[model samples]
Target chain A: MSGVKQRVPQIILTVVALLLIASAFVARPEGGSAPLGPRLLAIADQEFATWFSILAVFAFLMGGLNLVATHLAKIRERGPDRFYSLVTLVSFLVVLVIGTAKLGGPPGLQGDVTAPGSWLTAVFDAVLSPLHATLYSLLAFYIASASYRAFRARSLESSLLLGSALVVLLGRIPAGRHLTAWIPEPLAFLRVEELSLWILRVPNTAGQRALMIGIALGVIALAVRMIAGVEKDPRSGGDGS
Target chain B: MSGWFAPGTWNIALVGAFVCAVIVFSVIRSRRGAMVAVRPLPPLLALDRAVADAVAGGRPVYFVAGSQDLDNMQTVAALAVLRPLARKVAEAGGRLFVPTNRSLVMDNAREICRRAYLDAGRADLWRDDWVAYISDDHLGFVARVDGLIARERPGLCVLMGFFASESLLLAEGGHHVGAVQIAGTASAVQLPFLVASCDHVLLGEELFAAGASLEGDAARLGSLRGQDLCKLAAAACLVAGSLVATLADVTGAQPWLFLRDAFLNVFRAG
Candidate 1:
């Protein structure tokens, strides 16, 4: 009985999905004059997608509670770390209360607490966005360090990589173009700017396309497996045996 | 409902049908007990060792399932790997800590871990704390993992799936704590961060392969056979198309140019 229960949903859902996909090819009936199958599939697709969006909203609220539970645990631990936890929770509550209660603005227009001039918006604009920007700025230093480690010249490949890196780096900035301005027009292709742009348009694009293709194939394989019921029976958590 | 069929997606539908045909063929052959060969991924090899090491030393294994909610495909596919890993850890009497930022993901992880432990006949080892929610904020999750890494000093760190800017920071933190790190992702932009910082890195498609192979089901693994065959066909097309275009460029031949366009038309969107 349990096995049947698991397999039934999987089979039905797969059929419904395949139907929806097939519906994309069937031309819509004009003025509801024909083709019941295509119309039903279209309805199923829209309804299912709307249902998914509703579920996502609920999940977002659940995620908020999850964050609260985690930080509350840290506060209960009673240590120096508790200070950070308290800060996070207090900040969360202040925003929640102010936003929910609509303390600043007129009532019933309470949603999107990050609206203009609200306290939540003020905190976001003055404090949180700046902090996010600060964190993003740290990535520049991290990128430099990572580039240093990656571009070190220790082997034949590394030497070529380092050379390529130097060219690309010099080509991107105006100072680099100025440094190579003395190169004759006859050998203009050797200029850092042209070389860098060529590298970006040619080799870099080629590599990116290859990666994108591979990812596409991987996704196709996964999607096919899902449609074929090959991965697992989601309910039983096994092959529908 | 915007009527029945949507235009401008026929190319995708055609490609999907081709892939589905290939998959159906492969699945049938696989079910008949034909061999579906898969190359061993080096990073996944390291994964086994790291898990074993964690078991031996009685240290915990930490898995970062990225910052995405449960809706993300990477997170969902990653559970294929997490389930088996949970089973292994349970059998070995060691612990696995999975920090999820989404409540739904946490719930899914708990169910997967529970089922895995039950399959391994170690259901007693399963605990809700094994997989729990942290915070949804990207940096918030990274900070929590950093503290966990610094304190627990896990024997193994598996960071995989969809990762964004926090990829390098969290991987570097794991490295700072001196754990054997194995990172995998299909995020093209974040691949280098994992490669530069981790002990072993699974680039792009290799992550999917790792998850499938760990599942140990031939029918599931057979999907890779179809993917490989499609890739081979794609490679042939690329080589042929490029040669035709080159010929057109060199000889300035109208016929060659016409052939090149014909080849390109197969892939071009309408």
Candidate 2:
């Protein structure tokens, strides 16, 4: 009975999927009211997708609870990371309360959570915005470090990759174009700008297309497996019979 | 307004039906003791070894799903990979920690882990908190994953799904922690970054197949083979279309032009 019950959700999900797949063929009007089947399909797809968002929004409450629980447990245990957990819990509560109560509303406009000159915007502008920027800026340093490691010419392939990367990088900038201005039109394709475009449109695009096609097929296969009841777990297909 | 079929998507529907039919037929054949050949994926093979080693050493394995909501296919693909991975961990008597950026992904990961543990007959080893939602902010999620890598020092990091600019950041963070990193994504721009930084990468469709291929189900494997046939047909179409287009351009030939248009119309026509 328990096993049968466990399969119930999966079964329903599969049935819904099959219906959607079938309904996708139904023709819908472009500028006017669609036929019943097509209209129903469109509505179903929209409703299902929206339900995912709604569920996720409700799941946010669970996340908050989990965060609080995890941090509180850490504090209770007095682990070495207890200080961090304490800080996290305290900050989380502060933000939750402030955001929930609309405490940042203007003095005369207490109802508007996002009122102009509100503390929420102030905190966002003065604190979180800068923090977001700081984290984004860290990417520059990381890219440089990663590039340095990747560009090391330790092998034939590595050397080719490094050389190609240098050409592409140089070709993209104005300085590289200026340096190649003296080159003749007959050899214009060898110029940095032309070479960069060729690499991007030709080899790069070719490789990307191969990957894209493979991924498309794989996703299709996954869907097929799901519909066939081979993939039982609607989330991950973890259970194999 | 009276029609039931979508005029614009008729071709797509037909293709989908054909593919689904092929998959179903393949599944039936597979169940009848027919052998289905699947090519070996080096990264997935390495994944098996890494999980076993990490478990034997009593080190935790971290699963980082893509930083996207349920709207993204990459997140779903990542969930697929988690199923087998969680089971592997449960069977090995090790812990699997999953930190997701989206609430839905967190729930999905938690359910996946629970199912894996239950399937392995070690449901007691699974913890409700094993999967946690870190943040919805993309960069914020990456920052949290970086912190987790630094603190937990997981023996292995499987970064799979749809990733963007933060792909290298996460891979590099795992690299800095000396963890064996296996990453996969369908993002063309991020593929090179992951390939360069991670120990192994499931390029493109490989990520999607990674999860499907985990259990070696005949239906899944057969569908994979069917997809290969579709790919070949697509490749042939591309080559033929390009040839006809080039001939028309070079010769000003009306026949080649008509052929090219006809071929394109099949795919693009409503």
Which model scores highest in TM-score?
2
The worst-scoring run of ten residues by lDDT in candidate 1 chain B lies at B1-10
Q: Each candidate's TM vs. the true structure?
A: 0.89, 0.91
What is candidate 2's CA lDDT for residue B269?
A: 43
Clashes of each: 0, 7
DockQ of 1: 0.44
Candidate 1's C-alpha runs over 4 A off are A23-39, A70-86, A109-112, A233-241, B1-8, B249-258
- lDDT (Cα atoms) of all candidates against the true structure: 0.78, 0.79
Write down the C-alpha DockQ for each prediction: 0.44, 0.59
lDDT of 2 by residue, A1-241 (tens): 7667657867886888877776667654455565566767778877877887788779887777777887788799998879878877886887777767677584443477677776677767887789789888877887887788788999998898898898899888889899888889999998888988988899888988787777777778777776666755644334343
Encode model 1's per-residue lDDT on A16-74: one tens digit a residue. 76876676686766667656777677677788889878987787787688768767876
